[model samples]
Structures are given as structure tokens and as C-alpha cells.
Target: MREYNVAILGATGAVGTRLIEQLEKSSIPVKAVKLLASKRSAGKVLQFNGQDVVVEEATPESFDDVDIVLASAGGAASKKFLPEAVKRGAVAVDNTSAFRMDPEVPLVVPEVNEKAIYDHKGIIANPNCSTIQMVVALKPIEDVAGLKQVIVSTYQAGSGAGQTAIAELDHQAQQHLNGEKMTADIFPVKSAKKHYPLAYNLLPQIDVFEEDGSTHEEWKMVHETKKIMEGDMNSDAVKVNATCVRVPVVIGHGESVFFEVEDSSKLTPAKVKELMQNGAGITLQDDPDNQIYPQPINAEGSTQTFVGRIREDQENPGSYNMWVVSDNLLKGAAANTVQIAEKLVEHDLVRVPAEYYGK
Candidate 1:
């Protein structure tokens, strides 16, 4: 087995921490794990493969001896250092929106489009958390029935907003129980003038709204779906519209998805359930008679994308309704990035071309 040196950027953030945990158990031979973060977080000790590694300030030089970089440090950090990683001869699998929409970057879900990994221009973009689970659930169906359109609404967890948002939820919940006034400093939109309490509350907006009346979070799902599943640069074949809401849950995201297919007569909800039961990284939990369906509370800390509530749409012949759930930080971000790195090693997709790294 060939050994690869890996670097993890944003080592302190929620998804970044999970990335470290996943990489520790990864099949790829990780020769060295370098944890990189902001200046303030430098010297922070994080354990990887049972050894404590001190976090370092992120810089172009950070990738000097790195072979693969898993970055979850947010879009700004990815935009700054991902190219630098590439220039220094490391392939960056970024968990940020910075390169997701770029025509050159592949928005990948390994189950749906692992082949996209071959096309990376040294940096590969992971799909949005919500988008990842949905596509994983829908991919098998799309292969069988031929997808036409997707309409999805997400019940996203507070943790998706990051650690501060999770703290805000805890603060608000405790305050509400004590009959004290609740304060929210991180949620909906953290920089917006007003923040709403996330405990026992639903905020229709996840990210700031754009001019098209869709919030940026919603638009990520919309555009990312088309890119990952359909691979449509022209954006004409697949249609997607998403409504993203922030819920009080701390880990998993639940989505209610409605999709239309070309061959409705051959497909049924039962067949879909059977397909999901045998699909990779997916579990079918749709036993409505026993009162079971995919729920966020049951999905925390798990890598599986859970699907349930498979039924035909009432008004549309070729359409079906389903529920999708997964840990936003695991299968959605870190696990997907790690899976790509494993694929790269297994396939020998991009070998360091003749002294490319001056190795």
C-alpha cells in the first residue's frame, strides 16, 4: 500500500474535526496528518491516529510535503489555500462553496458521480450537505426511471450553521425553560441585523437571500443538484428548486423530496424501497405501518443516508415523495471527501507526474 501525507484545513471547526476522525480510520495509508487552522487556533492540540498534532497557521507552504488535503475551513479559507495546495502538488478535496459552482470544479457525490474525480483540476469540491444526501437517495431511482425534476425542502440542523449556532440553540433552550428572554447571536443569517431563537423555532432562511428571492442556502441545493446528478453545464436537462429551513436539531438534516421520472408505469414505491435497501451508503427505513421513516434524531453520528416515506405524488403520475436524512458533517462533508481520497489512491487516478512535487 502506498502511503500519502494528508493535510486537514479548518481543523477546529465542526466538520473539520469530524474530517480528522474519519481520516484516522481511513483505509488509505496516511503517512502524516497535518492539522491547519487560523492564526488564533495555532498550537491547539488535536489527536490524529492516536498522536496529538499541534495545529498550524494555514499558508501556501503548509502543503509542501502533503499529498492530499481535506479542507472544511469554509469558503474563504478554501479559496485562499486550495489553489496553493494544488500548486505545491497536493490534490485538495474542498468542503466549501468557493469552487462548487465553477464550471471547472466537479461537484461530486461518490455514489452518484465518482467518475467526476478524474476531471478535477487538482481541487475537487464536495457537494453541499443537503445536496449530498438527496442525490445519494435519488441516484438509483434516476438510473431506473430517468429523472426529470426535483423539488426539495430541507429541515436543516443548527450545527449546519457551525459551532456558534449550536451554542446559540443550547443558550436559547435553557433560557426558555427558565422563563428568561432568549438571545440568538448565530442563526438564519449570523451577520444579519436580527437573529432568531432556534430552539422550538423554524427559520425559513439558512443563508442570505439573493435577488431571485431564493436564499443562498436554497440555491446551493438547487444548482448543486443539477451539477452532481445531471452534470449539466448548460443547466437544461434537470430542474431543481429547494426551500431550506433551519430547525433545532443539532446534527442531521431531513429533506422532503419530490421528484418526477420519465417512466412512471414501471416504477413503484415498493421497488424504490428495495433499491435503497441494497444501495451503497443508504438505508431504507420506510415502514409506515410500524411508524418508521427517516428522522434527524435517529441519524446523528451515522454515515448512512437514510431514506423513507416513499409514496406516489397525489396529483402527478410520474412523481414520488420521499424523506432523506444524514449527518451533515459526516456523509455530507468529511466522509465524502475521504471517500474521494480513497478512490484516488485505489484508482491511481492522478499520480505525481515525474518529480511534480520535487519528491
Candidate 2:
């Protein structure tokens, strides 16, 4: 029943604001809340649990006396400020990709790998948006039949790119309606030389392409999945590959996941439904008779991961396919971070590990 002082880095952005809302609704004992952002966002007032809190520019001193920090800032900001937070005795859960691949950090989805938090060296990592929902939907299957491979094709929302990309989609949609030439700036990659309109179209690229012809987002899903689902960082036990696409939607992200289990006999649609029926934070919406399935529009605001369109792959005996949907900002980023913070308190493991000092 002890309350802890909490600091939220990047308190004004999309995911940052959702983090605040999740914290407000979470069961963590919050003694005091601090809102930290960039200088441009400083002095902006936001409500938390009905009280107005002004955003402060984040710095090393901002983390003083903070017990927990929910960081949704960009990689640079997380790389810059999280160590300071840990140095000042705060256990931070990061939403950026900064520490997810780090051997020292635990890449977690609460419903899937919550126990891995026990090994955190002060900073726990939230996995990629697509990876988070995929793992959550797969946990039930992994419990029933061991996982061997994960192949996901994501129809992600423009919001996944950021707040600006959402607005770009809106503008382009209107432009298309008016028959005006839609402008392109933020689709494939912000820094890429060529850009494309994301309204009423799909871009197969999420992040920049690597030399191997896979986007960074795809690589993240491939590698991060292996790390989160395996105790061995380099384990090839579970194979993961992703095809990421940016769709016209605004909030929720949808994934078509094809997975192969170790034992085919243990899992069928009925048995998968049985496991999902008892799974934590999972919703089984599979129904082919009346046309029921998970959709991004129906999943926008909720943090729960929805699964539907479950069926066995005709081509492969041991593989199955399902549709997974969740709010990209909530379940994928903000709510997941809050869940980790709650686990930290519940397990009484909030202090920084000694080995992580000056690291």
C-alpha cells in the first residue's frame, strides 16, 4: 500500500498521453506524478487522475526522487535520459526501441513474458507494436502447443508512424476525394528520399530497408520475438519473419499471423479457442457462420488483444492462421509500459541492479 513517485518522460505525445491515462486507471500506488517532455512541450498542462500537472523539460535532475519512469520518448531521448533515471534510483520502463535489443534489458509483453521482468537491470523494454500483440495472441497457443515459427503480415495504422502521419493520412484522404493530387511526406520512412501517400494505399515498408531487403520493423519483429519468447537470446528455436505495411487506418493495428507449433495434434481451432478463452487479456472472436472476426476499427481504444479468423492452413499440416488486433498506442506502447510498472511494484523489484550502475 505504499505510494511511489512516478515520472513520465515525453508526457505530451500520443503514446506519452496514453501512458498517463493508463497509469491513472492502473492499480499502481502512485504517490506523486511528474510529467516531463521536451522544451517545446514544457509548461503544457495535462490532467492526471483529475489534477492538472504541468509538463517539465526532461533532464538528469527531473528524475530526482522518482521511483518509476514510464518513457515514451524517442530513442535518442531514452538513450539520453533513462540512464540518469536509473542512476537516481528509478526503475524505468521504456517504450522506444532504444533498449529492446539490449542483452541487459527484458523485452516484455506483460501477458506473455511478465516473469522476465525479474532480471531487469533498472530498465525494462516494451517491444515493437506489432510484436507485442503478436506475442500476446500467441501466448495461449504457446501454452497449449510449443511454438516453432511466427510469420506475420501487419496492416498497421498511420498512427503507428506518429501523430503527424495520422494527420497526413487525413489530408490525403480529403485530397483524394476532391481529386487533388495528394501530397506525400511521411509514409515509408521520414528520412527516405522517396515518399508515398498512405491514404487509401498500402506501403510494404514500415521502417527503412536494411541491406538484406528487410525493413527495420520487419527485423524487429523477427529478432524481438525470438528474444521475448526464449530464455536464450540467440535461440533459433522459434523462427519469426514479418511483412510490415502501413494502411489507411488511424489507431488500431491489425496483424495476420501464420504460426507453426511443435506438435500439430495438440492444437486445432477448438483447442486454440479453449486456451484463448482462459488466456489473460486475450479475446477470442472467431466465428465464420455469422461473419465475426477481429478488426482494427473495433479495437481502437481497448488495450485487449483480439484474435479471430482462426483456421488451419490447408497447405501446411502443423500451421495455423489468425487475425490479431490491438490499439497500437495503448496495448502496444502505453498500457504495456504501465503493466510492467505494476509488475515491478507487485514483485517488490523497483530498485536498480548494482551491475547496471554507470551503464
Candidate 3:
């Protein structure tokens, strides 16, 4: 078995910590593990394979002799250091939205488009967390019956925003319970004019709103779904629409997805259930009689995407509806990023290009 030296950027973050855990159980044999983070996070200890690894401040030199880089740092940090890591001979699997839409970079969902990993020029972008699970649930349907459209409404967790948002949700919940004035910060777009509490309430917004009145999170779902499924951002084959909302939940994300098939006569609820039941990385729980269905609470720590409530739209026979749930930090972000690295190794595409080595 060959072992590769791996580096995890943003080692102390929510997703970064999960990456460390996944790597411990991953099939990829790891020769060494390096933990990199911001200056403030340097010296913090994180456990991996039963050993404590100290976090180091990330720099171009950190990629020296590194084979794989799992990057979960913010967009700015990824945009700055990922290229440097690639230049030094490490294949980077990025979790931020930094390079997802770049023509030179491959935005991949392993189950949906594993072949796209080979097209990478030293970097592979992991689709947004929300997009990752939705595509996983829809890929089987798309394969069995050609997909024509996707409309999704997400019930996203506080963890999607970051650790600070998670803490704020908890703090606000306590304040609301005690009849104290709740403080609003780090939510509904922290830089926006108004901040809202995500405790005991839902905010119909995830990221900053675009001029077209769609949130950035919604646009990512719209654009990323096309790129991951069809391999082109401008593909008109599958039209996607998303409505993202931030709920008070702490770990899992749930989505209500309605999809239309090109060949309506061949697709049915029972057939869709059968496809989902046999699909990779998917669990079917569609037993309406027994009240069995996917939920965020039941999906908290699992890597598999839970799908249920399979049925066809009464008004539109061509369209069907299903519910999808998964651990946003694991499968949605960390596990998916690690899976891309594993695919690269499986296909023997792990080596840095000759032109990028040492330059």
C-alpha cells in the first residue's frame, strides 16, 4: 500500500476538524498529516489517528513534500494559498467557493461526476455543502430518467455559517428563554444592514442577496448543480432553482427537492424509490405508512445522504418530490473533499503536473 503525505488547511475550523476525522478512516494510506491554520489558531492541538498534531500557520512553504491538501479555509485564504500549494506539487481539494466556477478547475461530486476529477489542473473544487447533498440525491434519478429541471428549498443549519454562527444561535436561544434582549450579529449576512436571530425563528436568507433578489447561496445551488451534473455552467439541459433558508438546527441540512424528468412516462414514484434504494451513498426511507422519512436529527453524524417521502407531483406528472438530509459538515463539506482526493489516488491522478512541481 502506498502512503501519501497529506496537509489539512484550516485545521481548527468546523469542517477542517471533520476532515481530520474522515482521513483517519479513509481508504487512502497517509504517510504523514500536517495541520495548517491562521496565525491565531497556530499551536492548537487536534487529534488524528490517536496522536495530537499541532496546527501551523499556512504558507506556501507548508506544501513542501505534501501530496494531498484538504483545504477548508475561507475563500480569501484558499484563493491566496491553494495555487501556491499546487505550485509546490500538492493536489488540492478545496471546500470553499473560490475556484468552483473556474473553467480550469473541476467542481466535483464523487458519485455524480468522478471522472471530472481527472480534468483538474492540480485543484478540484468541492461544490457548496447544500449543493453536494442535493446532487447526490438527484443523480440516480437523472441517470434513470433524464433530468429537465430541479427546484429545491433548503432548511439549512447554523453550522453552515461557521462556528461563530453556531455559538450565536445557542446564545440567542438562552437569551430568548430567559426573556433577555438577544444580540444580533454574524447572521443574515454579517455585513448587511440588519442581522436576525436564528433561534426559534427562520431567516429566509443564507448569504448576501444579489441584485436579482436571489441570495448568493441560492445562486450557488443553481449554478453548481448544472456544473456538477452536466459539466457546463451554461448547460440548458437541466434548469435549477433554489430557495435557501437558515434554521436553528445545529448539525444537519434538509432539502425538499422537486425534479422534472424529460421522459415522464417512464418515471414513477416506485421506480424513483427503487433507484434511490440502490444508489451509492444514498439511503431510502420512504415508508409513509410507518411514518418513516429523513430528518435532520436522525442524520446528524452520518456520511450517507438520507432520502425519503418519494412521490410524484399531482399537478405535473413529469415532476416528482423527495426529501434529502445529511450531515452538512461531514458529507456536505469534509467527506466530499476527502472523497475527491481518494478518487484522484484511485485513478492514479494524484501526482502534480511536471510544470507545477517546484514552481
Candidate 4:
């Protein structure tokens, strides 16, 4: 097998760290590993294959000689550097929302849309963490029955924000334990005018709200799901609605999903479980009698999306309800990013397509 030079952007952050760790266990034929972060993280040393690799400050020239770039940096960095990386001959799997809705960029969830990796001009987008797990859980059903509508309520982990938010959650927990007023800093939105404590509390907001009163995170879930499953970014082919909330957990994200199948409108819970059992990259945990449903703690480190609590919606004949859970950092971002890179290699799409040059 031939090897490719891989780069990890935002190499010091939560998702970036997981990207490095995921690459260690991944099957990509990696010739060399390069770690890229901001200047503060540049001198830091990290490990891949048990050897030390120094993190470098990312620049436009960072993509030179890099075959694959797994980027989990902020949207700003991705918007600025990914195009340069592509121009310099590297195919990037971006884990930011910067280009997800772009008509030319394919927002991919490996289990749901592996074939979409071939459509990359220079960048393949890893869907949002919440969107990734939801699509993985939905793909099996969408494959068998056609999707009509999807409504998801997410219990997102603080780690979804970044390492700082997770740490702040811990601090707030301690403060509450000691009867001190908890301080607010990163939760909700960092740059927003106000912040809130996430310990023993849920923030109904995930990101700053848009003009329509929906947070950006919620909007991503809606549109990203449509693009990945239906390949129609703005089309109502599969109606997606999301309510994103920040839970007190540190790593795993849990979602309550209700979906209606168009083709198999009469699809029962049993059939749903059967599809999930045979579904790629998903685990079935639907034994309610034994209290064995998917939960965030149990899904803390696993790459597979966990689905359970399957039942038919009583009010709606064609609708079913279920719970989906996965490690936000793993299958949601880093693992999904690396999986796209693996698919790219499997399909020999290491270079930007000439057709995408003008995009």
C-alpha cells in the first residue's frame, strides 16, 4: 500500500487531539504526520505511532507536500487555509462548518455518504458533530425506507464547544458543590454578550441565535442532514428540524429523534431495529425491558453511533422515535474526518479534481 503524508490542523484542541489519536488506530497508509495549530500551540510536541511530532503554526505554505489534511480548526482558519491547502496539492477533510453548505463542497458522514468523498474539489467537509451522529443513525433507515421528515432534540456535551468549555463545566460543578455562585465564561457562546454555567443546568442555546431565533448549531443540523442524506442542501426532500441544548456531560452527545419514512411509511420499530442491526457504523441497544438503551456515558469513547429506545409514534402513523448517542469528539468530528480521508484514499482521490479548480 502506498503511504500519504497527513496533516492535523488545530492539533492542540479537543477535536484535533482526537484526530491525532484516531489516526493512530486508522488504516490510512500514513507516510508522515504533521501537526498544525496556532502559534501558542506550535512549539508543543505530540505523538503519533508512539514517536514525537512537533506542532507547527499553520500558514498557507503548511499544505506543501501534505497529501491529506484533517482540519478541526475554527471556521476562520479553515476558510483561510483550506483553499491554500488545496491549491498546494493537498486534499483536506474539514471538520468546520465553513464550507458545508457550499454547492461545490460535499458535507460527508462516512457511513451515510462515503461516495460523496469523490466529489471533493479540494475540500471534503465532515458534518457537524451532532449532524454526523444523527446521519449515521438515520442512514440505515434512509437506505431502506425513504426519509420524509426528521426532528431531533440534542443533549450536547460541553466538550463540543472546546477544551475550555469542558474545563469550565468542571469548575462550575465544584463551585456548586461548595455552595459558591458558579461563574460563567464559555458555555452558550463565548463571544456572545452573556455566558452561563453549564453545571447541573442545561442551556437551551448552543450557538448565537440567527435572525429567525434558531441558533447556528440548530441550523447546521437542519441543512447538513439534508445535504448528507438527500444531497439537496436547500431542498425539502427530507425535512430536518433541530433543537440544540448544551448538557452537563463532557464528551458524549445524546439525541432524541423522531422521523417519518416516506417509502416505508408503515415501517415498525422491529424493522427499524433490524435495519440498525445490519447498519454500518451503528450499534443497536434497544432492549427497554432490560433498561439497555443508548446513553452518553456508555458511548463516551466509541466510534459507532448507538441507537435505541425504538418505538412507533402513536400520533403519527408513519413516524418512529429513537435515541442516538456517540462520542462528540470521535464519530462526530475527528473519527469522521479521518474516515473521509480513508474513503478518499480508497477511491484514489488524493488530488483536487480539475473540475473543482474554479469552485
TM-score of 1: 0.95
Local accuracy of candidate 3 as per-residue lDDT tens digits, 72-188 = 989999999998989888899999999999878889999988888876778899999999999999888878778898999999999998888889999999999999988889887
**Model 1: colliding residue pairs:** none
lDDT value, residue 226 of candidate 1? 82
- Listed per candidate, the RMSD to the true structure in angstroms reads 2.6, 1.5, 1.8, 1.7
Candidates' C-alpha lDDT: 0.87, 0.90, 0.90, 0.89
Query: TM-score of every model?
Result: 0.95, 0.97, 0.97, 0.97
What are the per-residue Cα lDDT tens digits for candidate 2 across 1-359? 77899999999888989999999999998999999999999999999999999999999999999999999889999999999999999999999999998888998888888889998889999999998999898887876778988888999988887778888899999999999999999887888999999898889999888999999999999988888888523335588888999889999999999999989999877887777778889988888897889988899889999998888889898899999999999998999999999999999989888887346
Against the true structure, whose lDDT is highest? Answer: 3
User: Candidate 1 on 1-359: residue-level lDDT in tens?
Assistant: 77989999999999989999888778888888999999999999989978989999999998998999999888899988988788778888899889999877778888988888776778888988999999999888887887888899999998988877888899999999999998888887888988889898999998888999999998998888888876723335578889999988999999999999878986887888888998888999999899999888899888899999999887887799999999998998888889888888888754444333212
Give the per-residue Cα lDDT of candidate 3 at 71.
96
Task: Write one digit per residue (lDDT tens) for candidate 4, span 1-359.
Answer: 87999999999999998999899998899999999999988899999999999999999998899999999889999999998888888899999989989888988887777777776799888888999889888888877777888999999999999999989999999999999999998888999899989999999998889899999999999888878877722334688989999999999999999998887554777899999999989999999789999988899889999999999988887799999999999999999888888888888999877765335
